[model samples]
Target: MFDTWSVRELANADHPPSVPLNPMGALPCIARLEDETGSSWWVAATANRWTTTHVLVLWRPDPRNHRQERLVWLRKADVRPWLHKEQATRT
Candidate 1:
């Protein structure tokens, strides 16, 4: 299923989202996702070393241990207009 989320919702998540990384190291971009279950997930998008596209890493804070986190990788295309729109507003 598909769902839309606002940049405000992400910024208000319990745990602040992680910053995306670059070849030179961490960049200032911060992305987040909201799932069907209403759980908020943090995301970090970094450019691939070889490709012009980006790799999005989704993260959720561990329920059992807040200090720990879980993550999964996704293509930037999955987030579509939301991610693209958010990035545009940032600049």
Candidate 2:
């Protein structure tokens, strides 16, 4: 069966990113996702829309290994648009 997660049930032990990373390794974080059953916010998911319902995510400081981050595919509905405070100020 297709898995359905309410933004919380989604896995944090993410899969390695399906694409390349920015050489700078900066948090070009474009969106956020909730973690820990929606009790807390995991606010560092970067999004590149890959489809109508899925997003390619760059989850930093991976829960499984801090030294290396991972890339994960998440449902678009499970994530919310995020803007860094600096960006928010400009727009």
Scored by lDDT, the top model is: 2
> Model 1, 44-76: lDDT tens per residue?
433221123433433334334445443333444
Q: Kindly give the stretch of ten consecutive residues in candidate 2 with the minimal lDDT sum.
A: 1-10
Q: Model 1 — TM-score against the truth? A: 0.28
Over 1-91, each residue of candidate 2 has an lDDT whose tens digit, in order, gives 1112334344443333453443333334544444565443454566653555556666654444556555566666556667667777954
Model 2 CA deviation exceeding 4 Å by range = 1-27, 30-40, 62-67, 85-91
Any runs in candidate 1 off by more than 4 Å, and if so which?
1-24, 37-51, 58-66, 77-91
Error of 1 at 41 (Å): 7.0
For each candidate, the alpha-carbon lDDT, in order, equals 0.38, 0.51
Quote each prediction's TM-score.
0.28, 0.43
In model 2, pairs of residues that clash are 17-71
